[model samples]
Each structure stands twice: as C-alpha cells, then as structure tokens.
Target chain A: MNHRIGWLIAGLVLALAGASQFLLNDYYQRVLSVIAINIILAVSLNLTNGISGDFSLGHAAFMAIGAYTSAVLTLPVRMKAIVLPDLPVWLGQLEVPFVFALVLGALLAALIAALVGTPVLRLRGHYLSVATLGLMVIVQVVALNWQPVTRGARGINGLPPFTTPLWAYGAMLLTVGIIWRVVHSPLGRAMIAVREDELGAACRGVRVFRTRLAAFIIGAAFASIAGGLWAHLITAITPASFSFLLTFNVVAMVVIGGMGSISGSVAGAVLLTLLPELLRRVETSLALGGQPLYGLSQVVIALLMLGVMIFRPGGLFGREELPAVLARFQRRRSAQRQAPHPSPSS
Target chain B: MFTPTYLAQQLINALNLGSLYALVAIGLTMVYGILRLINFAHGDMMTLGAYLALAGISALVLPAWAALVLPMLVIALVGVLIERLAYRPLRGAPEVAMLITSLAVSSLIQNGATMLLTAQPRPLRVPSALTQRIAFGDLSIAVMDLGIIALAAVLMVALGVFVKRTTIGIAMRACSENLRAAQLMGVDVNRVIVVAFAISAGLAGAAGVLWSSKFGLVDPFMGFVPGLKAFVAAVIGGIGSIPGAMLGGYLLGFAEVFFVAFAPPELSGYRDAFVFALLLIVLLVRPAGLLGRGEVNRA
Candidate 1:
C-alpha cells in the first residue's frame, strides 16, 4: 500500500516484461513488442476518448504523422536519396538519432493535435468524431499524394529496427505513469467532470475547453510515441498501416476494457493482442465441413466484441480500477468485522 | 481549359455518382434524424444488399428482377433486425455507446461477409443492354448511368410522397420531431423507428445493386469508403434534413468530379483530401450546413 512498494512492483513488472523477450522466439518477441505498443496506444486514447469524452477517431492519423516523422528523420542519407530524390537538401543530409527522432515525432504530433483540438474540441460528441475522421482522411490523402516528402503510395522502407521489448515496454510504462498522474491530478478531475457533464463543469468554473484540449494533446503525444515504436519495430512505414482499421482496433481495446480505466486498457490491449494470434492457430488447425475456415479469426473477434458490448457494455472492469477494487474489498472486510453481531438463535 | 463536350461528360459522371450518394445520404439522415445515432453500419447494409443480389442471381439462378427485389426486401428485414438487436438495447445509452455498437455491427457484417465469401472482388452480372453505351456527339454515356439517374429521381419523389402523404410516414416524422411527445400521443414508437430503419435500408439496398452493377464489382469492404462519403454528404447537406442530404450529395459529387477532372494529373490523388477539407470548412463556417437552420436536434 506504500507508494515506494507500488513503484517497486511496477518496476519489477517492467523488468519481467523485458526479460521475457529473451525467452521468446522471434515471433513471440514481435508479438510482445506489438502488445506493449498497443497498450500504449490504448491508454493514451483513453485519456481523451475515455477520460475526457472527446470521441476522436483520428488517433491513427496522429500515429501516421509520428511514424512518418520518425521514419524520415532516422532514415539513412543514401536510402533517402533513393526513396525521396526530391527531398530538401537540409532534410536529406540530416539524420537524427533514433531517440531524438522519436521525441521529435511525438512533439510534432502534439503540435498538430493542439492546432486541430483548438477548433475541433469546440464540437460535441458525434460532430467531433466525424470531424476527427475527416482529419484522418485528410492526413491519409496527404500522405498518399505528397510524393516528395512521403514517397507517396510507394511508402518508406528499409529503416533501422531500433524497437526492443525494453524500449517498447519502457515507453508504455512512461505513458501509463504520465496518464495516471494526469487523471488523478486536479486538472484530470476537471477533465472527468467535463466528461460527466460539460455544462455543469463549465458552470462550476472548470475551464472545460482547456481541460479537453490538454487531454487531447497528451493522448496524441503518447500515441505518437507508440507509432514511432511501431514504425521502427516493423522497419517500414506505409500510409495503409494507419487506416481506420487501426483506429477500430484501439477503440475496441478501450471499449473492451472499461473506457476510462488505465489498468483496464492494459488488460484489454494485452488480451486482445494475444487473442488474434491464438485464433489464427485455431483457424488453421480446425476444419469444419471439410473446409479450412481462413478468415474465421476476424469473424470470431467481431462477434465476440458484439457479445461483450451487448452483455458487458461497461467492459470487464468498468470504471472501478484494479487498486480501487482491492481498496473496496479491504473496506468491506473492515466494515464486516466492526458490525454488530446477529442473534445466535436465528 | 475545359472543353464543352468534356464538361458535359464530367457533368454526367457527377450526376451518376451524385444519385448513389443521395440514396446513401437519405438512409443515413433518416436513421440519424429519428435515432440520433450515426448508423455506421449503413454502408455495410449496402454491401450486404449487393452481396445478396449477387447470391440470388449467380448462386440461386434467380431472374434479374427477382435478384434485385429479393435483396432489397431481405436487407430491409436485416436492417430492422439490426435495429432490434444491436440498437434497441442501447436506446438510452450514451451517444458513444450507440456509436461504438453501430461500428461493431458494421465490422461484424463486413468481417462475416469476408469469412463466408472471400475478400476477392467478384464481378457483378447486369444485363449487357443496361450497360450499353449511348453516344451524344463527343460525349458518350452508359445506359446504366441514365437508368440510375432516372431511378434515383423516381425513388426520391416516391420517398418524398410517402413521407408527406402516408399515415405511417406521418408517425415517423412526428417521432423525429419529438420522440417522447409522439409516444405519449399514441404513436407506436417502436414500430415507427423500425419502419424508418426498414425504409432507409431498403433505399440503401437499391443503391447497392445499382452501384455494384455500374461498377461491376462486389466486395465486402466496398461499402466502407462510400459509407464515409455518404456521411460527408449527409453532414454537408445538414445531418437530419432529407433535402439537405440530396443537395450535399450532389455538391460533393460535382466537387469530386471537377477536382479530379481539372486538377493537375499529379494532384488527382488528393481528390479525397479536397472533399475532407470542404467538410472541415463547412463544419467550421456553417456547422448547420448550407440548407440547415442553426438548430441541431439532440436525443
């Protein structure tokens, strides 16, 4: 229950995650890396979509921006010549270190988010969502057409693979810590208040617009880092990678976990990432009516998600988080111990 | 820089495309007007209709007329079933919950189709006579295009008359106006909502068959882009206004065709970008749309 002990446990979990990569085969290692990146993506999105109630569908657009930024920065000079021959001399000659490139990528994403959020955050609910989706379509179309900067539809390939389990999980922990601190802060409470009742929050003197914008920027920054990690891990970047499907997957993670719960996002991310891989195996091994059910994995996922939405719409943990659940259990036990005794005759 | 004949051809293309967008936008706006939920599954319903037609014709060897009518009827029921199963439970849920549920339903239908029928696009088989080309000076048009335009206009008029003159249609309009009041005033609320969804889906089904036959392809994810574009059309016209949806759809069609036709060859790929930019501009400048009053109806 002590803060130090909690920090120790968190550090230990990160260490274990890092150590497991050594034990895993190449495929499992890749999967673990993906799981960590996805968790980061899910949690960051939860800050805006879950905590602030913004309902943005453009998370992948920011990811795409981040991935492309990091990729362009870290790409080798010679490869840049081949891929983007019309690249500016300054950009073509300059190659930043991977760490700085990742930071720059995230910063750029946050900057864009700030600009977008200023106008977009004013809209409510479905309008905001549609605007964000429009932004995504704009981003994708730009990436598809901006040949000099993005290599257009050809995409960028042959980048260095700098993403490891340690980097991925370490970045995820940093994201989780930042989000946890923000949501628990006074500002975070304001954001949640806005989510609960925007008009009421404004009436109570909460700077509603500012709080929503903060969550959006923070979520965008972390999503950008996840995107950077994903790009580096895959050693290639494409406009196609950051499509609506990516947005859907992250949204699924948020919904399947309690939307506003950080721990729930982690659980949802990890479980959902592993599920499809498991399903793929099952699909290949199992045959029905003498036919190999090739795409059953996605079908099952969609159906299962629907079932969860129908039956457990609040998600597995709902808004009560891991620590909160434990605290409630302790409180209940104490109350039971202090209660007046019942009649023995009864 | 534009030739008269080329301009005329592009205009024809725009009208053809606009008709499809109008059908989709009407469906989207109707459901959104009543339910106040953006039915993301509308596009998937269109895809389902197309696929059903494909099955009826190719697999069951049904007549072409049978293929078209059967799919529209079936998908209308499917739309009602979707409303009953996926949406009815979330009637009072938060906007996000319903939005996400519609998204889930969309993906479920899309992925289920992919699983049952491979993702490979199959060519649709409309009669050659329908697709036959008719020349007008330097501008040639497919009979299919003319048929689609005529069909779309007739359907729109029919829908307008139905909404204005029929008793059930009056109930739907009342429900959309004020749901609780309509319920209190003896409207069969559930039936009205179900009827709205069925009508919307039926229109979407008709659009789907026409779209597939015109394009000569049927695929699971085919509806996704068109669906988003239809949403754009709906938004631009005004979210809940039928006439606004049609106007927006036509504007979008003209914008898309002209942008591609006139822009430099290299910039042609940015056509969608132009559309989205128009959307953002419209959202910022006139959130109510060109035809909409400033009021945005909320559930």
Candidate 2:
C-alpha cells in the first residue's frame, strides 16, 4: 500500500479507538486516556533516549513543569486566590483557555529544556543520567517547596477534566505521526547516526551536539505536552504525579517496545499500562501462603523489564515498525508457499 | 544559634552522614569505574541488606552484630547473582540499556520488598550501646556515630591497601584502567567484574546498616534519596577515583548539613534543591570531578 493509504488506515483506526471510549466503562475509559498519555510520553522520550542516544532520567521533571504551568494557568482566578494567596499578581489574575495553557506550558517546558540542554547536553552516558536525575529531584523538591506557585505539594485541585478520550487520543495520534515523520526526516537520520556512532557522525560533518540538543529540546516539549494532557485528565496536579517512577515506566515502555520504533513504543505503552490493571485484578484473586499479593504488578513489571533487557536487548520490535513486522511475516509466508518443499531446517 | 557547640555538633553530624555516604559512593564508583554503568539498583541492594538485617533481628531472632554481618554477606551474594544474571549478558549492549536494566532491577527489588512488607516505615530496635550518647568536652555524640566514622575510616584504609597490594584488587584497578589490556594480561575479566560487584555491594550493605541504624527506620524505598546523594558524592569526588568518592561523600555531607544549619530557616526545605544545583554547577565547571582523571567522551 502507498504511504498515504497506510496513514489513512492508521488514522481511521485511531479514530475508531477514540470513538470506542463510549463502549467502555468509566474505569476502562480512564485507562484508555492514560494509555494515550503514556504513548505521548514514551514516543517523546524515544526521541532523546532511543534515537539520539541520550540516557536521561528527567523526562518527568519536564512533565511536572508543564503540568504545573497548565494547572496554574487554567485554574479559576477565584480558586487560585484561595489556594495560592501568594501567587504573583499577574499570574493570580490570569486564567486562559485549556488549549492556550497547554501550549504555554509546553513552551515553558521546552524553554527550560533548551536552557538545561545548553549546559547539560554536554555530559554523556551515566554522568548525563545522574545529572538529569538530579534535575528531576530538584524539580520535585521545588514543586514540593514552592508554595507560592505549586502550593507546596497540596497541588492544584478542581481542575476541569478537559482531557476527554477524543483529546487524549488525538494528541497521541499527533505525537506518533509527527515523531514518525521526524524519524524519517534528514535531521532524524542525523540523530540516528549520532546514536549509532557519535564520533563517526561528527567525523561525517554531522553536528553532534546540535543534533542531540535539538532532540532533547523537542523530546522535552512533547513530554510537557503529555504532562498537560495528564493534568487535565486527572483534574488534579501534584508534584508526586511526575516522579521518577513515571519516568521509569516510560523508559520501560521505550525499552520493551523497541526503543527506536514509534510503533514499538506505542505497543510498550499500551501493554505496560494494561498489564498493571490486569495484575491488580489478579493480585486480589491470587494468594501466596494465604496472604493476598500486594505490589505484584510492580514486581512483575520490573521482572518483565529485566527479562526484556537480558533476553531481547533490542526489544520485542527491535528497530522494526509495525508495518515492517507485518511485511516480514508476509514475506516469510510467501517464501514458504513458493518453495516446492520446505527444508527441514526451514 | 551558630554557637561553637552547635557548629561542632553539626560538624559531627556531617561526618556521621559523610561516613555512610563515603561507603555508598565508593561502592558506586567502583562499579562505574569498571563497568561504566551506574547501577541504579546499588541503592536498592542497600535496602535489601537493611531489610535482611531487619528480618534477621525480628524473624530469625539473631543478635545485633550477627544480624549486621549476615546481611552484608547475603547482599554480597545477591550482588554477585545480579552481575552474573542481569548485567553479564548485556556486556556488549548499549549503555542506555544497561542503565534501564539497573533501574528495573532496583524497582524489582524495592517492589518485592513492598509486596512482602508494605511501605510502612518500620522503626528498628538496636542494641543500646549503638545509640547511647557519649560526652566529649562540650560535645555529646552517639556511640553509633563514632563507631560508624571509625568503621568507615578502617574500611577505607583497608580498601586502599587491598587495591594497592592484593592481586585481585590490582586486577580490578587494571580492568578499570583498560579492559582489553587487562584481558590481554590474562586477567579474568568476568571474575574481576563479579568481584567488583561483590565488594561494592558489600560496602553498600555495610553502609545500609549504618544508615538505617542512624535513621532508626527501614522501608522499601529508603535507598532512593541516599542513593542519589551517594551518586552526587561519587560525581563530585571523581566517578572513577576511590579516594575521590570518599572525599566527595564527605563534602556532600558537610554541604547538605551546613546548608540546613546556616541557610535561612524558610529555605531549609530547598536544601535538596541546593544539593542538586551544586551537582549541576560541578558538572558544568568540573565534569572530571575533584580528583578524577578527565572527562571521557561519553558521547
């Protein structure tokens, strides 16, 4: 099929999935929205982590920034007066539409990313990882302590649930489509080259630092966007919501789905999100030594991640997308059918 | 009050915290020095060691000293197992994969602990000698604090000697210097790696006991903040330098304590924020750390 046709089918599928929310119970619908948000997170992270080859543990920090920005921006002025009596006069009086707040929040996160990336993008490997982890902790501490802005961990409440299934799924589709296009673009190829071999990419006249910085900034922006969606979906925002655990979950999705592939990230996000709920149900039903299992889902997630890392380091999809996987399967089937007789080894 | 006695007390507290940080940082640095992967689970191993000790005291009804030593051994074994099972196969994989795996293993252990024993922070009952205060001139100090400091000093010295004298320790140093050259010299690379993990985890286990004893509590997720601080210490000291890790740990301990001690009362809550900001400053200014050789081309 042509690229246009392929994209049309994917778009149709996403629309149907969004529409199917009406068929689901409230709990399932909520779960679906969460899945969509998670997809945004995983795909955005993949830009820096999988494609650009940076190991960051601070994606959630950016999410926190976005969530707070969106929350503070959209919260009713009267409500803000009660919760954040100390907020700046300008910020206190202002209340924008959710879309504008989301965009501004995302922009603020991207701006922070650019500033942070300028200095932080230089460190490599574990150093970069720790630095980003430090960044995340700093953001968390700020959110917990910055009473004037974030209400010192009481968090903003009574947020309107603007993240309906349509909005969430729509954002997810947009993120995936854009990122997919970027990955196939020249700049994305440059990023992949850097991921493959930074020194070689630099030798070939690819601006290693610039490419990485761009990826980091773009990734951070999208993560912030996801964070905004999440804030609206939950109708509340807290610093705790964007902790390292969330970052870890996103990392798990990227790694398990095949880090560099958009489709793989989507699969990982969906599977990981659904797996916990399924396990939560199982936990109540199953008993170990006459005691109900608690935190079984978390243990299982960790073990699954470890298993994936050890056994399938490239992830389930590796570098292949969904279309590629399907095409490969079809080729194998066709090859078998064309053969007069299948070889024993085959 | 910034009186002399108060300052002295803060100094002692800093040193006490620094001792544990040093131990944890050294372990973290050793692993990073050899494998170049930050074992995010190192902190969790510390948690496991503390939990084991807790389990021994309560369930197995072991004596305090016995409880302390047993957990270290168990954690060391666990560390070796982790090296062989989780990390070994990923030797040739990208660094990012290794990092994620470490995180997975960390969460796996922490979540398992939570499942077994819920997230409630349990107060530990220690032998009175460890917690008893001893008067020293104008300063009154816990025997546990002094003991921890002395123990850390002794361990550091012993580690220095071992790395300088023992064949295996030397092999570890050599491997950290150049893995391929060490292999060419007939150094058993895998054995060195395993021993690195074992020794590191053992130190982390010891630090875990010291930390929990100092704090008087144990929980599933206790290792995270301390682990991050230890990483900060490691980074500040020079990631690959053993002495650097120790120095960084003490510096961090002092900085953290003193920042709280001296900073405006309203800003005490931002102490962690300041600590991270310090890390960022250090990374930007001196990426090689205080005594580290030079910044590697991590890209």
The lDDT leader among the candidates is: 2
Task: Note the residue pairs that clash in candidate 2.
Answer: none
Residues B1-299 of candidate 2 have per-residue lDDT tens digits of 78899999999999988899999999999999988888899998779888888888878999887887898898899999998889988988777777888999988988888888877899877788788898988899999888889989998999999999999999999998888999999999999999989989999998888788788899998998889889999989999899999999999999999999999998999988898888888877887899998855444
TM-score of chain B of each: 0.95, 0.97
- What is the fnat of candidate 2? 0.75
Q: What would the TM-scores of all predictions be? A: 0.95, 0.96
Candidate 2 Cα outliers beyond 4 Å, as residue runs: A10-14, A289-291, A340-346
Error of 1 at A100 (Å): 1.7
Top candidate (TM-score): 2
lDDT per model vs. reference: 0.85, 0.87
Off by over 4 Å in 1: A287-292, A332-346, B297-299
lDDT string for model 2 (A1-346, tens) is: 5678768967886777677777887787789889999999999998988889887777899899888988889889999898888999999999999889888988888888777676677766656677778889888999999889998778888887888878888888888888888999999999999989888998999998889988988888889889888988888888787776888889999999998888889999999999988898788788777767888998888999999888888888998889889999997898799885767665
TM-score, candidate number 2: 0.96
* Candidate 1 lDDT, B96-209, residue by residue in tens: 888888888888888777777767899989877887899988889999899889989998999999989999988888877778999999999899989999989988998898
DockQ of each: 0.53, 0.69
